[model samples]
Target: MLTFLLLRQLVQNAQSSSSSETVYLPLVTQPLIQSLPDAQQNHIQWMLDEAPYPALSAQAITVNLAEHEYLFLIGGGEQFNPQTGRLEQTSRVTRVELDENGQLGTWSDTGDLPHLPRRLHGFTATAVENMIFIIGGLNYPAGNSPIPRFNNKVYCAEVAENGTFDSWKARNQTWKINADTSYDYEESMAYHAAVFLNGRLYVMGGLRRGLYFSQSWDATRYVFSAEIDHSCEDLVWEQEETLPVPIRGHSAVAFERSDDKISEQAIYLFGGVTNDENDPTAVSYRANVGENGLEEWTPQAVIPGSAGIHAGTAVRSDEYLYYIAGTTQYDPKQNSARDNVYQTKILPDGDLQPWKALNALEYLYGHAAAVSTLGRLYVIGGAIVTNSTQMPLIQNTIYWTPLLFFSKESNPVGMVFPGEEIQYRFTIRSNNVRDLPGLVISDTLPTDLELVSAPNFFQNDRLLSSIRITLPINSKTWQTYTAVVTQPEIPVTINASTATATETVLPTNTSTLTAPATPTSTPPIRPTDDKTCVVSEVAPDSGTPRPKPTCTPTPVVTLSTTPTNTNTPTPTNTPTPTPTAMPTAVPEPVVVINVAELCFEGRCIWKSTAVTAPNRVYLPQIAK
Candidate 1:
């Protein structure tokens, strides 16, 4: 039965497209193993041995070794033990290998964190090259002490090429207390976010629980940074700019933007609880990393339905930022675990577009999620709430799916006139760490538009409606096509066309992804030129030289007065001076054509000219 299920999954993956429903891997750990058949029990046991036990609030990171890529899952709160029927916390570390095709190998036990008697949770772990740094979190001591201890120590370890870790060494310099305060301001914090950017580790907002004086928890707005030394021994934390507001259980992700000449690195902060522990804020912020530290953060678009989100995981895949499952409410008795996944696009200017919903997951929170080098997203252990008892149930199930990055955009966003030729750029970006082969991009044009020229992939003169190209890892390839508007049939016609890119992988196939171009609309309006007009072409027999033209004026009328014959003319009385009829010399009809230049792909092309005659104006038929 296990073999059959695996075969079925492979078949489904091969035939799946991006628009189809998301396909999840089979559940690795099941809760009701004892009630199942013996064969089923054996299969469950086999999977459990290769997977981590049920836990929550763990931190995950992807490490790329010399030849293989591995995902490391660090400390988390093991909420339950079925054998003892008790709750537990763990300092255990596990890892899984990701194959070239983005398939996961069996999970292996790496080593447990040392030097601390208690297990930790709500901490952050970051990878700087081959070394991993474990930052502040809450430590749970053994035996009846229900209160969790806050920590300020920083731990560092080196990961070997075989995906094993060396002994973790504690840094000599730890988080320091503020000089003005009697107590530590943000030195000991948990449920915070940390990111490594440009050789520096940045720690953002988090919750600091009062240990000595009071048991109340307060959210902090502090930000700190440290320069990581080559030997990982002299790491020192330096305070940076604080956040606009205090927050906890948030997520932070940093990415480098090389779209322009001056490359920039940016950090984004997502949804979390504010000062009030139960109040989650949908507000997000973005800031650029500079030589000193982070610049002022600018508020971005608020995430929809994110007011209830906390303890979510945010990961960046290419140009997209994804926020995974998080708890909605602070109380354990409420249904706090959320299954929604929010996604947003990271613009070139380090701003974010509006957030949109993707496929939902199992109702869980405090899960660890990471993107493998092969462009696959993996969600590790989390906990779900029971409906009847409102108790939390820790889950060991692991789920993963492929991530696709592609976009289509039109150059002229606003108004497209009739007979106007515009350009459409289709960009395909590979988020994988290795090159992806056999990528087919298919574009469908609207009926009202005609394709003038497209990218020549085969070097042949013939035009192709679609293209097949290979995408280099962590890079983007774009192609532009010239299209002309044939008719302005409706008041506002949106050229909503889709382009699909299908990747063909061996052994395990990935899905085909589709991205539609931002709609280009053509509103009905009379074509008019705003600049000085020049005659581009003239009739053959007219013998008129091409020159800048002006609007012809109507012939002015004048009255001829007889001057001194004043007396004589007056005597004629007024025989209303018989006006002589003027003979009008008719000019030949000249067609005034307005020419505009359109450039694309470093080459300029002429747009169709509007022809106006002496007595009538009309749009000329553009030759194909």
Candidate 2:
């Protein structure tokens, strides 16, 4: 009996761990706090798990365009044990793909990397068109050999014609990987950072050596230095400003904005580990980092939630930068465990702030890679925490989120469909936004919507700031375009002064209902008709189908009585037909219209703000 019960328990456990089917986390009708317990709602968000290549972490990650997928150059080979499970280490490389449908592909091994495997390193794509740049990492030796290998090699490769990798070309000779030069402390650097900006790649803080013993403070003197030429290809080495403090296994982000038509600018550095990789509170900094040594590297703000490592990916959308994912300090003090996602935004003035939590990740990611297309940020696989030294199987997991903005400058896009005519009205409100009152509103419609009339312009001259414009649409089919409101740029190198122009359109539902009473100022209202009429595109079950109506249909009829002011017709007929005229009856037309679409600035849906009567139809018609 005891043996039978144990066997049954094993069977149940195996069933519970199956990944063949998805187990959904019960959704809250409204967003709720994670602490509040509802037994039905609790679930594990597992995006990636055991796969063929499980031991890879901290390898180079980049996108393969021809395949339209993401590839990870990981460390370690797969390890399997029937009793316990699979073990992943930091000695293998793996590739994760994202197809056109915005889904991640299965984990497949690319042929072995040209160089020996390593982990806890940093890599990023180059801005020189389409190339991937991989920097230094710690190489872990496999098998009976207890020797360790740390790589100072810098590799460069491009996505090529065939679907396979070209040879790994060396960009520069290897050098010591440390932190920004301004700090006095450093640790064994495993996970450092590198980013490409202004035609140069900037390397940030990370571990310089492995922490073998508990007393590692003396080992923290390594500072992260800037190296413009590690590849030996470019002999020019320039150091930007040092980071606020020494950080290892931390992430570096370089944000650029080119939409302003001005030169692109970058919002640099953020969170990572300091000298004590296992302790979070000990790794703190107190310096401000500006562009180059021209400005001091300062810690302006701390990331909001728990700090994490190997969890950073820098993504730029339009004008904002999002630093996402990583684990916190591995020890017990800072956190029970590091969460997988955090978000931060750069202010217009260029300052770093604390990170806020985003949606929970499926698993822990460190040393991951990312690429942005359209509006989604795609994060490839990294490592899940298994043990201190033991690397688990590299599970192929992909995670992402839509790029959303709450900025006042966020513009709604307009779209038109093929072969369809649509009229549009554009309105602007400047009641509260003083800086944007007089900005010009300009937009282009899709091919289907032809501009038949100039935009209707309105302004509250008394306010002196607010302005509005309306455009009549004649669109033919489905399409979309961006509606931009820009402050006129004046040529001014006069004082070297700069100001971010402000622009805002009013909330759609808040428009005023009142209009001026002048003949030219108000829209015409149709006269009301009280005649009994019933018309529908759908015919009644017992009635004959009626003729369809044209633009306007009138019912026709004859009256038995004649008014004194109106003409009276004489009676005539083989059977004396009365000719007294009453209101003329015109045949009302019945029209069948299909609502192919209803859209707003981007996507369309019915608005709850206003409602029209059911009696009204697109084409006017009289019912008999």
Candidate 3:
């Protein structure tokens, strides 16, 4: 019979190919390949030879490990082509592998995922296991304005040694997580914060879609809210705690250590926007979401400069978290990128500290990425902020900054006490007047700190902005002391005309004291010199006024050469009296530049000294 003959041929082929390793199968039953026309086949072959394309424009970071190193699996987000008015659905997993030798390489395409594309989701590898779990993201339409398509389902996958990846079937409803009572649509948010904590994955702060539709603008309603959920292995989502603020495009990192592990460990959050709508004025927050769903936040701390969405961050260790690139701020009304890189540190007390203006990335309003590896922080691809107002384009770039640990070598130099007068000085040198600078310094005063004296500072919009102020600290109130300095550019030039002598104030308690200006014509005063300060006394409790500091010993400006001209008269020399009625004196500059070799979360971080103009040695100028 035909079957008998085929079986005999198959056995013969197997035995014949046994020595060769690759055995051939009989073609008697399997379907044969359907050949196409010559021209069609050529087109198909050309398509097959092309390189793989990415599925999403903006995607989150996820990792799968092999042989102790990491393999990044990034995918799923929204993509739009403004020129073509073309919007594409993005939902696929792409792998970039770190090979056995610790080199980065890409793997060939495997297969499509079980689900379609969605944005703002959570994915993580199982603890001590080779399994990966992905849950909840919004599935938007494939067009310019995609909204309302939210994916609440959860999925998992495992990869084998042979480079084959297959997703596991959806987990059954072993545990169901319901929506938070305070939030109507807890499961619907994109670009929210998700982290694997304590045996469960915790999610917080995302937008709520589907509340408004184009077809029913009249019936429109707003349900923007914050949520935290755990306790589900499948489709069932149980809501836990509600976030104190609504946020999106935020990043979270978990700190795990053995000591006081239960309550002491925390998940710190950075830069994000509020609610579903985009507003540049919106502020960001930092909080701790406990295992029991209890949320606690530090007293409000604003992101110092221009805050933006989708910024990148790297957790160098437990205490120091660095934020890099992102759109500076979203003015949806204008639809442009607010590109800027703002970096700040979070104190152990859970405060959402302001971004330090001194440190900024090169590109502005672009989606910057970051990661900490081998004791250093690596920033990866993101768009740069350029003619954002004209033509916004995606940027493929890479940059990095070292995590400088704080040290006692560069300890903070200035301090303020309650109900006390303090003077701080800041100086700027310039080779050209066109080089403009701006500065803002804030002090963390005790609760009862008083600003009896207004800020008296010099600001030349065309040249420089510098200040030295003296403030009265309230003795009854107490808090940490802090300040910030922002300049148009770092490493300002020191020209011959610039004076190196800056005001110096000793710690003192006083009523109305006038300080005589140091003589510039004399040799510069040394730091060791003990000098007297003039006084126009006014009792603290009495209602009386006094004359301000006067021009005693006149100061002179001396140029190198004297001109021999008849028409031009020699410039007169007069001692310029210090502006006594000037607003509050600028605090004397005693910036604590502490360099510490700290061990944070089992890694070393070096905090470098804060220099004049440029705070760090190699940092780029902050793009306004």
- TM-score of every model? 0.57, 0.47, 0.45
Query: Candidate 1 vs candidate 2: which has greater TM-score?
Result: 1
Better of 1 and 3 by TM-score: 1
Give the winner by lDDT. Answer: 1
lDDT of 1: 0.63
Worst 10 residues of 1 by lDDT: 40-49
Q: Please give the RMSD of candidate 1 to the true structure.
A: 29.9
State each model's CA lDDT, in order. Answer: 0.63, 0.39, 0.38
Residue-pair clashes per candidate, as listed?
Answer: 0, 86, 57
Which runs in model 1 stand beyond 4 Å of their true positions?
1-50, 81-87, 110-118, 175-187, 209-215, 278-280, 404-624
Cα lDDT tens digits for candidate 3, 1-624: 343355456545555542322222222221121222222110111101111333223343434344333443344323345564333444555545433212345545646433333443222222213445555454545555534455555555565544346655455322233443333353444555556655556666654444345322110112121222332244344555545556666666665544453345556666666644445643444445555643554434555543545544434333445555455444322344433444444555555456544334445332424243332333433434345254343433333332221112111233322224332232221111011122222222212222333344222332112142211111111112222332211122222122234444444433443444444455433343333457674432243443454434434434323333325333334444443332232222221221212233323322122212112222111111
For residues 421-488, write the lDDT of model 2, one tens digit per residue: 33333222211101111123233332223333332322232111112322111111112222221211
Query: Total clashes, candidate 1?
Result: 0
- Tens digits of per-residue lDDT for model 1, 1-624: 343355356545544543222122332221121121122110111111124677688888899888778888887877754444344778887777776545578778444434233378888989888888888888756666656777677788888888876578776555544422433644567889999988889999887765456757777787888887655675667777778888888999988867447688988998888876555457588888887788888898777888858877888876777888787786554776788777777776778888877657778888887776544667788888777354688777777653224444554543455677767665554433224555654444455567787754322232233455566544556677777767542223121122223443334324443443334553444444444444555442243543446654344333333222222111221223343443332222222222222222222211212222223211221112
